[model samples]
Target: MHIQLLGGFRLDCGPGPVHVVPGARRLLALLALRDSPVPRRVAAALLWPDTTERRAGACLRSSLWRLVKPETPLIVVTEDALVLGAEVDVDFRRACAFAAAPGASPEAVTMLKADLLPGWWQPWVEAERDWWHQARLRALEVLSDRFRVSGDRHHAYQAALAAVQTDPLRESAHRTLVELHLADGNPAQAVRQYQSYRTRLRAELGLEPSSHIHELVRPLLR
Candidate 1:
């Protein structure tokens, strides 16, 4: 059983997809992202945040009734908690593990390159999505630096470019790209990237790039 929650919500039972309503999908997604047994009260509260506890609890029960099956158990219910089925796996969890490594294979970047449950603006979902974004950004920065140190300029540039594309305002990402261009004997490209960042920063935030990043491209600017 596989649950995909990185780019979007999907469920694969074995050979085909399982159809579920939007309410059920949200419940399952919340539990899957939590990656642990959520206390019944806590689950109810989060799912129906604006309602009274009693009403939310009732809503939780209705959703659970539609979800729980006798033969195909998708959730394991304990005394006070709701647990994801033991055999179920979440793609976001796997993506996080992949993003945790600095020197991962190039293909693994695909797993790190997705927004968590895109289009969902719930507080919990937004928090997790932001967390994943920052984590992937760190992973990309490290991967770029590692490739740069190893003299793999092509891969280094790719990673740095991806980082900048992922978050255009990230100073470290711009710095990485500048360094990569300089390493590839293109001071002109380095200066171009630095100038682009400087212009963007000034336009968006009324600020300049940090001294650390400015120093990286200062020689070329002169």
Candidate 2:
């Protein structure tokens, strides 16, 4: 069985995709992400923090029960904890491992491109989502740098631009894009990129670009 948490939540049990309710999906995702047994109380509280503890526990029980079937069980329920079945494979774990490596294959890069569980508003999900976003942005930056050094300028530019798009306010990504432009003998484009970052930074945070960033584009300005 394969479970996908990036882009969205999905479960494939070989025959086809398994249908899961939203609460159950979230439960399975949380378990898959933890990749270890989680205390039932803790899982319930994290998933339904707004509800009373008893109600949250009841909700968790219902979700866990829904994951059980005569043919296959997706979750393992213990006296005090819950965990994904041993047979399950989670995509987020694989993507994170690949992203942290020195260089990623094209397929790995494609996997990293997805946003984690898009549209989920739970606090835990949101935090994990932010983590994945930053992870992918960093991975893209690494990929861009590697491509630039290896004389693959076109792919380098695309990767850098992807990092910028992932987090427009991230100065490092913008810097990478600028560096790529400068390397390609496009000083004008580098200046344009810096100016755009400066404008957005000032508008969004009422702040100026750092001196470090200014230094990067100063030569182009002259």
Candidate 3:
């Protein structure tokens, strides 16, 4: 299965265009929130809090039925359990697992293509979006630390650049860029990064860069 959790949630069965309904997506998200198999009643309450028990039960049944048809390969649900079907493969879950581990593979760090569901602007998606965003940032932070610890300043610099591209407003990224440049004997580049950050922060927030930011690259300004 070609499962994509990056942008909203999409699951393709092999090369076919199988559709996963909204309820299924909701159910998947709920399941993903838990480490162990969540109880059926709890799942029902979370998704259908506004409805009566009977109606919510019906909706849950209907949603699962649609996903378990012969042609569907997205999920496997037994009497009291639900999970990603054995045939399905999800990159986001895998990437998240790798990112959470202490010694995650560099390949896993490289797989996070973009912020999760960047164009999606639904209130329902916010929680998941925040979770993935934090995970992605942590992965990059770990990668940067690994590079710096290993005496690979170039890779550390590149990781910092990638972090800035992901989140330009982050003063930490600019700090990393400045530190990396100055460490590599490129004080001019460090100054340029600081100037750009100062201008952007002032323009956007109508405020000066933080005192910590100023202190970070003060020597390079000389």
lDDT of each: 0.84, 0.84, 0.70
Q: Summarize candidate 2's per-residue lDDT along 87-177 as a digit string, tens digits.
A: 7889998888878884734666677778888888888888888888888988988888888888888877777787777789999879888
TM-score ranking of the models: 1, 2, 3
Over 139-187, each residue of candidate 1 has an lDDT whose tens digit, in order, gives: 8888887877887788778887888888999999999888778777899
Candidate 1: where is the Cα deviation over 4 Å? 68-72
Q: What are the candidates' C-alpha RMSDs? A: 2.2, 2.4, 3.5
lDDT of 2: 0.84
Q: What is candidate 3's CA lDDT for residue 125?
A: 56
Who is ahead in lDDT, 2 or 3?
2
For residue 222, what is the lDDT in candidate 3? 63
Model 2, TM vs. native: 0.86
**TM-score against truth, every candidate:** 0.88, 0.86, 0.75
Off by over 4 Å in 2: 68-72
